[model samples]
Target chain A: AQSVTQPDARVTVSEGASLQLRCKYSYSATPYLFWYVQYPRQGLQLLLKYYSGDPVVQGVNSFEAEFSKSNSSFHLQKASVHWSDSAVYFCALSMTNSAGNKLTFGIGTRVLVRP
Target chain B: AQTIHQWPVAEIKAVGSPLSLGCTIKGKSSPNLYWYWQATGGTLQQLFYSITVGQVESVVQLNLSASRPKDDQFILSTEKLLLSHSGFYLCAWAGDSGNTLYFGEGSRLIVV
Candidate 1:
């Protein structure tokens, strides 16, 4: 079974600071990885996804993620974060061979940006 | 231009009462629909999925049943509601098998 692990439960940073949320996956095959963000009382929105190709993929709102096959990691990074960027982030993985395409998600990391 | 809609943004129900929730997908054909549950400020747990009309797969089976009557409509029903069933329910769909999913706004249920 494919699984995702997000190590940080909560992260706080000042505005204009760079941000990185760690994510690790356990899967034998090359998995489809994704980053999603959810605001308070709102549905989750996709930030980006990585299937295969270049390790780094850009997403909406100036977010990017790098997929490291060797370490089985897909970490989300942003060069600069704003106060509006504060939200819960989730890393998810799905096996390519799995027909259902069910996504296994991490526990999530809550980000708070101080002004 | 795919979009998913879930009705009744929030619902409050009593234990033992019957319940029904509806979801509809737009701008897609024969999409793979899914139902998920999430606790307050928690992770999403897959409850059910439907690959096509009239077929539904139960993943959690938390005293609930799902049906897909049309190509774009998925409905979740329960004979009797439980206090434990109170949570946020989300509807999602993928353009095809093993494709990326899009989520709905979600329906918040509070069972008392």
Candidate 2:
């Protein structure tokens, strides 16, 4: 079984400040990693995903995440944040298989970007 | 472009009431359909997924049932509603690659 853990439950950052969300995964082999953002009362939007290739992957709205196989972690980062960036971000893991591509998600980190 | 729509944007039902939710995918044929449940202030749990019509697979049973009636339609239902079922229900679809999933706006359920 695979699982994801997000260490931060909530984070508060001022506008124009850098932000980072931590995520750790437990999987025997390399797993597909993703970052998704959910706005208030809205469905989740895919931020970025990583399988192999480059260690760092860029996503929509200037978001990016790095996959570290050695540490079994995939952390999301942004150079700067805006008030509109306030939302709940989730880290998810999916293994390549034939069985419907099920995803296991982390508890999510609620980010509050202050103006 | 592919689009997924979930019906009954929001619904309020009493406990023990029968409930049904619908999802339809447009511009995509034979896409993998999925149902996910999210509790208030919590992560998402995949309830069911269907690769083709009449072949639905359960991921985590929440006393709910799902069915793919058509190539583009997926339905989630339960005979009786529970307070635990009060949350957000998201409908998603994956293309042939099946690497990434696209989600719908979601429906909010409030069970009293």
The candidate that achieves the highest TM-score relative to the unseen native structure: 2
Encode model 2's per-residue lDDT on B1-112: one tens digit a residue: 9989999899999999999999999999889999999999999999999999999999898989999999999999999999999999999998649989889999999999
Q: What residue runs in model 1 are displaced by over 4 Å at the alpha carbon?
A: none
DockQ of each: 0.72, 0.90
lDDT of 1 by residue, A15-43 (tens): 99999999999998898899999898878
Residue B112 CA displacement from its true place in model 2, Å: 0.4
Fnat per predicted structure, each in turn: 0.51, 0.83
Tens digits of per-residue lDDT, candidate 2, A1-115, equal: 8999999999999999999999999998899899999999999999999999999999999999999999999999999999999999999999888488999999999999999
Instruction: Please give the distance, in angstroms, between residue B111's alpha carbon in candidate 2 and its true position after superposition.
Output: 0.5
Q: Given candidate 2, what's the lDDT at residue A44?
A: 93
Error of 1 at B111 (Å): 1.2
DockQ, Cα level, model 2: 0.90
